[model samples]
Target: MKIIRSKSFTGERAWAALDIANMNGITTRLHWTDQPYKWHTNDGEEVFVVLDGQVQMRYRDLGVEREVLLEVGDIFYASVGTEHVAHPVGAARILVVESEGSV
Candidate 1:
């Protein structure tokens, strides 16, 4: 079995991710970032979990922009067709589960 230590995880670049699982047409990943991700809609749905640090999560609903602060242990769910982006407060580690090959 492989084990990961989230606290010591770092990437060569922002938003770098490591695949944890790829099964049943779904993918689970561990991501490290210190930058904002571009807004985009998922192919299916997405479940985001903050493992370390904080994030400013922005989304659009009814053409209106909104944002929320996601702290450690917080979770964010994005339904299909939901436009959203994430900006880290600094360096952060996030666990993301989504449809395989989705962006």
Candidate 2:
């Protein structure tokens, strides 16, 4: 087990890649920021845990759009091949756990 502190980050967005599991894989920590960005992959699913602040997750598919709000202690999952983006409503922190595979 390991502990990642928030102060280790150089910018507004801090990150730490942790190998907590051997079979399923590990996790990544994403510090909150105002930037809106999209993430997609053909590899595997991604699990997100909201540690602090608020975030809006948007999913788009075949002209259809869906949005969800995530607060602290909330968890969300996104399957592979799903085009999505997440933006911080204020300042937020999220823990992302993904299966080890090609992206």
**Count of residue pairs whose backbone atoms collide, per candidate:** 0, 0
On TM-score, the leading prediction is: 1
Write down the TM-score of every candidate: 0.97, 0.69
lDDT of each: 0.96, 0.65
- Stretches of candidate 2 exceeding 4 Å from the true structure: 5-25, 61-63, 100-103
CA lDDT for candidate 1: 0.96
Worst 10 residues of 1 by lDDT: 1-10
Write the residue-wise lDDT of candidate 2 on 1-103 in tens digits.
6566643433444332433444546445455455665565536778888777788988877768888999888887877777777887856666677766534
- Residue 26 accuracy (lDDT) in model 2: 48
Q: Top lDDT: which candidate number? A: 1
lDDT of 2 at 39: 60
